[model samples]
Target: MSRTLVIGDIHGGLKALEQVLERAHVTTNDKLIFLGDFVDGWNDTPFVIDFLIDLDKTHNCVFIQGNHEEMLLRWLSEGHDNEEWRLHGGQSTVDVYGKIDADRVSAHINFLIKLNDYHLDDQNRLFVHAGFTNQKGVEYEYFKGMFCWDRTLWEAALSMDATLGRKDLFYPQRLALYEEIFIGHTPVTRIGYSVPVNRANVWNVDTGAAFKGRLTIMDVDTKEFWQSRPLPELYPDEKGRN
Candidate 1:
């Protein structure tokens, strides 16, 4: 099979995303695994969604639902007006698609609702928007908190050497389950982080493109990566949260 490339948070930084793909020289045979956050915090949410949908139609693309995407689906299901939605970039989404007819909106919401929580490729790579489950009485399969806000699993996965003061954080150590995990949802200062805990695997590829940081992509098998520097701020010009 061809190699798979995993991409991290877009956050509406379509320009950066496109540039990263160009730099990576992504080909038709290569698979793209997107770690969600497809929209929000930037001006091109509609364009990004449309581009992603088209890409999926033409290529082999696997996308996991990020917390921001989950929020969008929730808002659509329960009426799109709430304090939380307004605070978390939903207003911009509404502004983009609110003028569209009801049928299109319903279709978009339905498309998002069907997204899977995680996707495991044949090559033994786990692709998810965030890290694995929570430790406090939450099953890994049911750990919604980890996907959106939990940092424990993310840190543990990246803590390569115990001497670095990270082992204590992941006490009762859980052996890694996959050969590699390609994840997003936490934008690191760098384009990617790797922990050789079990093998030469485990990677976090979120570079916070929407926050005037880099956008990144990594090949799952070869570990080849590419990044695009952020452009100057445009529109609304406010800081965003993870």
Candidate 2:
């Protein structure tokens, strides 16, 4: 049977992305849902976009918009670069395309502009770059920015001690809107895990590919995961986002 593979924040670690895909044995039949942050950090931002474009041709790929992508889009469209974005890995993305190709950059901009805020699969699995503030089902159209920037949802999940006996009392009702919620943005490495972290029905899969951890991909149905070598190991000569 075909499976659904949910990937974490890529952050331009092309090699890590490639390795995780290979390890996961992803095929055209499998649905691939990327949690975003596809660019920035590592030096292969352009290459990462090119690869994903190619991958989408063969597979069922759902790309979610990330805060980094949002920042990049704002910079491109508004012609005013955000210093904060540049400081947090966007500079590397700009550096990758030193002398920007207007046509290519335009294409990339279009791609980024068209990214969805979130995706809900047939199984009621909600995939987003970050968490939502909605207490009911995700209102991505209304809270596009929050879909890729909010941490309150994850923070709420983290605060709940699943080890406690009463799950319904501790787990927020918002999370129950979906059978499972998969997110990126907040890397699992912050919690000291190099693997996907699960809390109630929310799963954080970003293993900090932009920093010290590796990129991760998980089979949504099976919960089986695949990870790349650490970012430092993948790109020895560069500091991704340390």
Candidate 3:
């Protein structure tokens, strides 16, 4: 049977992204879901976008909008840079693509603008760049920002006392809405894990590709995972966002 692979935040680490894909042995037959943050941090933001565009032509790929993508899109459309975005590696993206042609920049903007806030597959697995507020279903159209900016959902999952036999007694409906929930905004490295962290039914795959950790890809069904080399090793010449 074909497999479904969900990838974590990329953060412009093109080499790391490629390494993770190769480690996963991704094929056109398999479905790939990216939990966004494709740009910002590393120096190859434009190349990362181009690589995904090319991959989409051959493989079944789903791209979800991340907070970085959100800020980039806003800057592109509003003709002004977001200070917060720039402070968090957005300047690296701007520095790389600042002098590119108008058409190419526009293409990147178009791609980022079309990314989904979240995706639900046939098996009921939820894929999102960040956690969602509603357990039923996200009102993506009205509160799209939450889909890529919320941390409370992940915090709730982490704080849940799984020791309690009756999980329903404490926020039962929250994560019970889906078979599995995959997110990327909060890096696992922050909690000292160089690998994906699983709490409750939520899986955080972002192994901190922009930091000292590696990028990760996990099989939705089997829960097996693959990872790239450390981010610093992948880009020896540049000091990424840090």
Candidate 4:
């Protein structure tokens, strides 16, 4: 069986990432799929990015982009004063880099810009950062809403009762291309195992590590899951999330 270790949003939690990887027992042969939002929330973006870059050199790894990463890229490229981004743990990421030098900041933005929007494996599995979509072909923007939005699609998919049939409401393109789609954006109260939504299989590993929640990792082949609580200081207030 193909072993894929899918991890939830890291949010710059380097300790959590290390702990979860150890708990999940990720090996060299296994594919490590990070569900994005690797920066922000925690004050360790520099360390997290450095570690992930090093990790990529050693193993097969896929890093999907998330909305926060998108915003970061936009601000860095356009010289936008993003106080809103800063409010939502973006400042923490900035803190890690220590007042972004032009060259170093460009390097970081380049890394974020290069992240894949989605990953579709031949094993009927789809991996994305923020959300999932039924859109296909020309409709799929390589760096558009498919990567960072689509929570509405998720909720509609989950509200279904059956586990095998497709839910029409969830399909933006009215096509069921994936038998199982794993995503990280909406943090479920539970962690580890797959959470089924109608015929749409959602494995949200985000565990809200940046908001007083756990860090989650799941083995896609075996459906095994692992979790660990986040540091209290990393917790965000309700308003902070806005």
> Which residue pairs in candidate 2 collide?
none
The C-alpha lDDT values of all candidates are 0.68, 0.88, 0.87, 0.70
Steric clash pairs (candidate 3): none
Badly placed stretches (over 4 Å) of model 4 are 99-103, 132-143, 167-175, 190-199, 233-242
Worst 10 residues of 3 by lDDT: 163-172
**Residue 76 in model 4: lDDT:** 71
| Decreasing lDDT order of the candidates | 2, 3, 4, 1
Q: Report the lDDT tens digits of candidate 2 across residue range 59-78.
A: 99999999998988887777
lDDT of 3 by residue, 1-242 (tens): 58999999999999999998998888889999999998999998989999998899999999999999988888877777777888788988888887778898889888987899899888888898887776666743356678999998799888888764334667557577777889999988888899889888889999998888899999988889999999899899888876
The lowest-lDDT stretch of 10 consecutive residues in candidate 2 is 162-171
Model 4 poorest 10 in a row by lDDT:
190-199
The sequence of per-residue lDDT tens digits that candidate 4 reaches over residues 18-55 is 88888877888899898888878777777787788889
TM for every model, in the order presented, reads 0.80, 0.95, 0.95, 0.82
Q: Is candidate 1 or candidate 4 better by lDDT?
A: 4
Model 4 residue 120 lDDT score: 82
